[model samples]
Target: MLKGRIIKALSGFYYVEHEGKLYETRARGKFRKTHETPLVGDIVSFQIENETGGYINEIHARKNSLMRPPVANIDQLLVTMSMKSPEFNYYLLDRFLAYGEAHDMEPVIVVTKTDLGNDVGKLEEIKNVYEGVYPIHFTDRNNINENLNDIFKDKLNVLSGQSGVGKSTLLNTLVPGLELHTAEISNALNRGKHTTRHVELVEVGGGFIADTPGFSTIEFSEIDKYNIKYCFPDFNAYSDDCKFRECSHINEPKCGVKSAVESGQLAKSRYDSYLAIHQEIDNRKERY
Candidate 1:
């Protein structure tokens, strides 16, 4: 048996890369009986039937998985946003960050379209707020190759951002010869159409990058509230100091998180996101 990683999955076939060679393979029958569908990024053991094709015998364990893109064992999520054009939505950015945090994946913020006049001072403000917690990269074509090459070196990363934020353009820039489609933002709607229809794990620059469809909505139902605070790296120090033993950091008078917010130690925006997600979890409880 040879070991390899599933680079792509389509139409009941998995394209695996083993020893620098790609092989078309199918999963074992046991996976079908167990209802276990192998996903992109899965490492598996397989037997070569022909020089070009094989049969996947066993699927190894996964480190993490996301339903939207359906990829597993993601090392980092490169969350992209624009400075102008469609504009940056802090709420949406926070949601993506929360999703990464919940899955134990590193979140890196990549701000695109820096050439578009950097209006409204939003880019600077975002960098100031998030730089302390996560790495941030700024890019336009002039410096995109340097920025992305430095960031994605020897790591498995995923590119996720608002539709018009130049994700596909960046991908094309990073990996030349890629034919990923790029679209213009609608003048009337101020949004770009979804161009990437499927999830694909592409080998690039001696590492792997998954190009996923732009997401309009992200759900956190798979995450539990008890562990949510851990996702916000900035909240770590204060969260441990909460007066109550079981402080949820909401409606608790002596909550350390709240105190930090009042004292301007923690960004009000981040705290607001926490409260918003907490409320959603609370509503879910009521429904249950």
Candidate 2:
């Protein structure tokens, strides 16, 4: 049996790369009995029955998994946003961060379209809110390569952001000949059309990137409330000091988090974002 990693899966066929060669393979019948579907980034054992195709025999364990893209073993999530055209939404960024934290993955924020008269002061405000906790990159033609090369090195990064934020354009610039589709933001609604319909892993700069479908919004109901605080890195220092061991950090008397917010130790905007997410989780609990 030959070993390979799956690069794409579509219509019951898996495209795997083995020893610089690509092969189209189908999973063995046992995988169906086991309810195992070969996903992108999965390492598998296969048998080449012919020159161009093979049969996937076994799949190794996964390090991580994402539902939307249905990929496995992601090392980092590159959350891309724009400075103006479509307007950057911090709430969306927070939701993505929460998702990353829930999955035990690292999240990095990338601000694009720096060449389009982006407000430096506004960008600074965002940086101030998240700088210490996550790595942030501002990219345009002048420094796009320099900035991205540093973060994407030796990691399986996913390029995710709202539509029309130039995600596909950025990928093309980084890895020429990628040939991914690019779409213009709707002039009427100022939103981007979905160009990537399916998830596929592409090799770039000695690393892999999973290009995912564009989304206007993300749901956080899948995450648990008890683990929400962990996603907000800035809240960590004061969370342990709450008077009650099970403090939710909202309306709890003598809560260290509240005190820190009152003392200006944390950005009010960040705190508000936390409260919003906490309330969302609380509301979801009522349903169950």
Candidate 3:
């Protein structure tokens, strides 16, 4: 038996890479009985049956996984967002950051299309809100952020964002000769067509990165209202000062987060996002 990491899964076969060699393998029938499907980025053990083919017999534990693109063991979530085309939405960006945090992946914000132009002071506003809170990069078609290139090293980074955010173009810029298919934004809907159909970890900067299909909506099914606040890193600084130790930071008296928001220490947009997401989770639970 040999151990390997699955790089790609297509047509009922998983392409596993072990020691610089890739072997086409299929999962054992037991996985079907267990209802556990093998996903890209899974570290698995398999037995070789032929020169190029094998059978995966076991799947190791994963740090985290996502079902939409069906990937596992991701270390970084590159929250790619566009500055213009579809327009940047702080709410959506916060959702991505919180989602990544809930799943134990480090979140890095990458704002694309700097050349597309925005209202005066838009860039500074973004920087003001997220600069000290997370690692963020601003890039355009002509110049990829230099700082962006260094974060991929030694991490299993996953690129994800809303459609028309230029995720594919950014990848092509970062990795020459990549030539990933990219589509123009549809003026009618103000969204880019989905181009990435499957997830495959491509080597970049001595690390692995996968480009996932862009999505507009994200669900917080795995996390609850009580725990969601922890996902917002900025809220951590003031959450402790709340009168209630188990403060939801909503409707709780002497709430430090609310105080920060009122005093202009924390962005109101961030507070609004927290309320929206908190209400969303509550509404979803009520429906169930």
Candidate 4:
């Protein structure tokens, strides 16, 4: 048996790469009975049938996985956001950040479209909110940030964002000859079409990155309201001081998180996002 990592999954076939060679493989029938579906980033052991074809006999353990993109063992999530066209939405960005944090994936903030307009106030606001909390990179179509060049080495990264945020354009810039399809934002709807059809790990800067389809909504179906607070890293500093050990940071007196927000130590936008997501999870539970 040979061990390999799955690079792509299309038309019920998995393209696994082993020792610089690609193999077309199918999962064993036991996986169907066990309800184990292999993902794109799964490390699998397969038995070779011929020179290029095989059957995946076993799947190795995974450190992490994402349901939306259906990728496993991701190290970083390069969350892309725009400054003007789609208009930077803090709520949306926070949602993505929380989603990544919940899945144990490191979140890196990438802001694009600096050349579109010079909105110093908007830029400053972004920096004020997330500068120290997370790594943020600014770039435009003509120039990619220099800091971004160093993060991909030896780490599996995923580029993801809302529609029309220049994710494909950014990928094209990062990996030359990729020429991924990019569409102009619609004037009436103010959203770009989903140009990326499938998930394929493309190597870049000595690592692999999957350019995934842009999505507008994210759900917290897997997480509960009580556990959602841990997803917000910014809340950690003040959460310890809350009066109750189980304080949810809402309607609890002497809550450290609330105090930090009131004292300007924590951005209110982040706190508001926490409330919004907490409410979302609560509402989801109510319906069920």
lDDT of 3 at 178: 76
Model 1: runs farther than 4 Å from truth?
A: 119-121, 184-199
Q: Write the per-residue lDDT of candidate 1 for residues 88-146, one digit (tens) a residue.
A: 77877787898888877788888888888846577677877898798888888567736
Compose the digit string of candidate 2's lDDT tens values, residues 1-288.
999889888778899888888899999999889998888889999999998779999999988776656788888887878877778778777777776777666888888888888588998898888898889988864567475777777678776777777777788778778766675533223233232235678777678888553343566766777878878888889988899988878878989899999998888877788889888988989998
- Candidate 1 global CA lDDT score: 0.78
* RMSD score of candidate 2 (Å): 3.4
Provide the overall lDDT of each model, using Cα atoms, as 2-decimal numbers: 0.78, 0.78, 0.86, 0.86
Instruction: Order the candidate numbers by TM-score, best to worst.
Output: 3, 4, 1, 2
For model 3, state the Cα shift of residue 32 in Å: 1.4
RMSD of each: 3.4, 3.4, 3.0, 3.0
Looking at candidate 1, what is the lDDT of residue 61?
91
Error of 2 at 180 (Å): 2.8
- Residue-level lDDT of model 4, residues 8-84, one tens digit each, is 98766889999999999999999999999888899999988987678999999998887656789999988989998
Clashing pairs in 1: none
Clashing pairs in 2: none
TM-score result, candidate 2: 0.86
Alpha carbon RMSD to native, model 3: 3.0
Q: Each model's TM-score? A: 0.89, 0.86, 0.91, 0.91
